[model samples]
Target: MVCRSVLLRSVAAAVLVASVSACSLWGGRAAKPVAAELGPNVAVLGVRQAWTARVGKIELPLELHVNGNVVTLASSDGVVAALDAKTGSDVWRAMLGEPLSTGPGSDGKTAAVVTRANALVALESGREKWRQQLPAQVFTPPLVAGGRVFVLSSDRSVAAYDGATGRRLWTQQRPGEPLVLRQAGVLLALGDTLVVGLSGRMVGMNPNTGVTQWELPLASPRGTNDVERLVELVGRVSRVGDSVCARAFQASVGCVNTARGAVAWTQVASGSEGIHGDDRAVFGTEGNGVVTAWSRVDGSRLWSMDRYKHRKLTAPLLLGRSIVFGDDSGTVHLVSRDDGAPLNRISTDGSGIAAAPAVASDTLVVVSRNGSVYGFRPD
Candidate 1:
């Protein structure tokens, strides 16, 4: 009887392993191997006006900024170029001595660019104002607030420098891996808090002196089993109003109280690649090809759609009453702010859109991966 029982246990274990393997085969849908098919039945708006320019002839055009009639483009070749926002005419160009990891920061009068070697170079109208070297590499764009430029370095140091003179103001260091500031780190001037998204957590710092206010861990503690490993992915944090939202791979979306440092709510999702929010809603895109929207107040899912499935999404761009997002196939989608319903769709010839579209007046400017910049106005 003991031998029979042992054999039966072994058989059950084998069956369980087989079932998991079968599920794994179909699960985790890799981005479709082939380029996505463009739908023929829908009417995509034609390009109203397209402008193409080569700035410094650099590859991997990472970040774009448009302030009034001035546009700045940062490239991997250690150069930042300013152009006319409407005509793409050259305004001025400045070359940093080292390759740039983060994009340019501007206060409409002065522009700050950080390099991989930790140098903060400030420029105005294409002329160098000052340069200062810090102790580590800066992977995140500098934030200009209250006459200071705040920079986050790969060595986990956050420092504030004089925006006009590159003078070091204050520095604070954390214990985790550094984070890249895709959009400028959220500065809540009213709360006196500066929010930064680190590797697996969201950190709140005092805006004035770079003091640690609070730190919130985002991911679950590591587990011993394979199931836990599958769920272990990095968390990304962003600020929407008084709340700081941290999203992790396969983990629940967590909203932390900016002032109290306590978790306000948590909502589960599958992937962490795309998570964005505004004053009204929280948005996330999962590996399963679903984009979901939730209420910012209570963490309730407002609406969901699979139309954006299988395509990588650009970060969500919040317009006045709508959200604009672009996918891998060069399709730009606008969804209603209230119901998440599709409002309009337009296609650009460019393949991959890396940054969120910039809006100036009534015009929307989108930069493609191939260096093609297109401007659109409502018809």
Candidate 2:
């Protein structure tokens, strides 16, 4: 009897171990995170700076807008300053309460500033035109279209007001979660529809009444709950001929049809929060340190180059025929857009180039993580 009892206990222990192993295998571990890389034949040659300026001491410089000879900057500290685009000199300054969340939207003469306090302030000649308050904080940059200024709140509500009078025109609420984990969405004005990207989905609504024109699912990775990651939609909603292009960085790039709300194609490239395109091609930096180009028509992979090892790339900036982007290590890379080949590289004195470089005609403006703005152009 004693022998029988011991044998029974051993068999039970073996069964338990087998059950645990099966659970471990079925629950699949998360995939290893890929690091950034640099492409081959890339050379680091120093470039000359045209100008540098201190905009003031702020935690984050939210937006940079260039208008004629004037450059406007909004900070997270509720300060807006207009600077001379050529000389980096101050033109005017305005102080608003609460942090400036989105960049300032302007209609040449008037500026619409969205605040973290859910207020939109209209400014002209360094004076307040009007202020309209909403129920939630504003995240994406406000769009000034059709003689109206549109502001998107965190609650997925789009509000439009008369640009000159601040008169409420329409308030359309897009279907969104009660709790949004990330700002990885865009408010784009394309023709009659206002486009917004949510978690695993994209919806186009009529700007007039806030009715859904079409809705489509953007294919994300099977297990990624992108909303929970708080990933902001960093790419612009660029209008390519009749189609619109945008990129999100949950697990891949979901290029979609703007008119039909259908995905044209999806790519496995990651860390593509910033996307820019030309007449023939689209360019962006992948999460794994690869700069790539894809055909805009069919979504075919054109060419890719790995330049650095495990360096996070900034958004792709179009400079003439070359694409420019900076990494976390203060290295700026300029690549030929024709074939995805590296052309030139420069090192900034700051810690890292976190923000996208601003290209104004012949001058390039870049901000460092250490709160310094540097301008460069070809000599």
Of the candidates shown, which would achieve the greatest lDDT relative to the real structure?
2
Summing lDDT over every window of 10 consecutive residues in candidate 2, give the lowest-scoring window: 13-22
Tell me the number of clashing residue pairs for each predicted model.
1, 12
| Number of the predicted model whose TM-score against the real structure is largest | 2
TM-score of each: 0.75, 0.78
* Error in Å for residue 61 of model 1: 8.9
Residue range 262-304, candidate 1, lDDT tens digits: 7777787765454567766787766555678877778898988
Error of 1 at 341 (Å): 4.1
How many clashes (backbone atoms < 3 Å, residues ≥3 apart in a chain or on different chains) does model 2 have?
12
